[model samples]
Target: MDDITIDRVLKSKDLLNLTDEELISLVEQYVPSQGCSGAAYGYLQIVSHICYFREHLQSKLMKIAIRPIIYLGINDHKEVLGFITGEYLIEKTYKPATEFGRDWIIGKLQLNETLLKDIFEEIVIEENIRF
Candidate 1:
């Protein structure tokens, strides 16, 4: 493993030490629009809290128990960066991004019709590619 890549994993492992609420908040910041469900502003001032319950079995394990590795591979003239262990530790809302990406696209598409249509093109085509 490259020294730089090893360092990055160690840093992410640091994130695992944070409380679950803190970790979820970080993810929510990256993805508030999806959770808000198209409600950008006040939608009745009911007090709210976010809670996630891991399956009883998985909760006992420490997040760092997951593997720690990163990979560099090329695709479509780009270097693909992948972390082997971010899979288990990242929240399920991110399970899509962690493994297959359709869930990520689905979350975004639910927020934007235009984005949904673009992703739904009947065939694999050039020029539609995003940079």
Candidate 2:
């Protein structure tokens, strides 16, 4: 996707107004061609936008956005998942909102269950930590 298209999609105030199908179509058309890093960035951008709009979005929309990231490559998954997990760990307000996104990706992608379990445990520990 060109910069113009990316801007148009990302900058649109009507993003939340779009039907789930339309949102999924936009993600499918724009995200995959950007290659691994670019695609991961694009997926994160979309998720950030969605998170900004509401604390939660439809799971189907989140799943559709995640598909390209997973399909791109396993290494890319580390980058994307790391960023999401990092945000959750550091951002006090993100909490279960980020958890929803992480869980959706974990459920959709075929990755090592044990590694993901470790990550989940870490997040749980961090969540219970007090200043």
Candidate 3:
């Protein structure tokens, strides 16, 4: 894979390892520059989607290994821009052969759900978090 792919893989792995508190600290550490905030928003958006989707589907969360949290940039009109792919992992042990739900998987990999929700709102508004 190329540098971008590798970057994503490492980022995902890095993200997956964070504790809920660490994840919040990670977000708090950044959020000033346009680029950083944009990427942060993108990450939260994907997580939110996964959570909402899993909730709506009532799907039992998964613990799949070697899963990739793939993303693509889309405009307000739903036009595709570019793709952002990352490797997401589950640190907790799981059953031998069952596929896990996105919520359960991403849940362990994230710091906190509330933080992600706020970040997502900022992204939706294209604004920085207040306080």
Which is the leading candidate under lDDT? 2
Question: What RMSD, rounded to one decimal, does every model reach?
Answer: 17.2, 11.9, 13.2
Question: For model 1, what is the error of residue 129's alpha carbon versus the real structure, in angstroms, after optimal superposition?
Answer: 32
Q: Which has the better lDDT: candidate 1, or candidate 2?
A: 2
Task: Report the Cα lDDT for candidate 2.
Answer: 0.47
lDDT of 1 by residue, 1-131 (tens): 21322123223344334455543344333322333311111110000111112222121221111101110111221111112113222423322222122232233322344422332231114324332
* Backbone clash pairs in model 2 (N, Cα, C under 3 Å; residues 3+ apart or in different chains), count: 0
Candidate 2 per-residue lDDT, tens place, 1-131, comes to 22334345555666656655565566656643456545545565565455445434434344444444444443343554554455432454312333434454444332444443444344335545322
lDDT-sorted candidate list, best first: 2, 3, 1
Clashing pairs in 1: none
- Is 1 or 3 the stronger prediction by TM-score? 3
Arrange candidates, best TM-score first. Answer: 2, 3, 1
Q: Considering every candidate listed, which one attains the maximal TM-score?
A: 2
Query: How much is the lDDT of residue 28 in candidate 1?
Result: 33
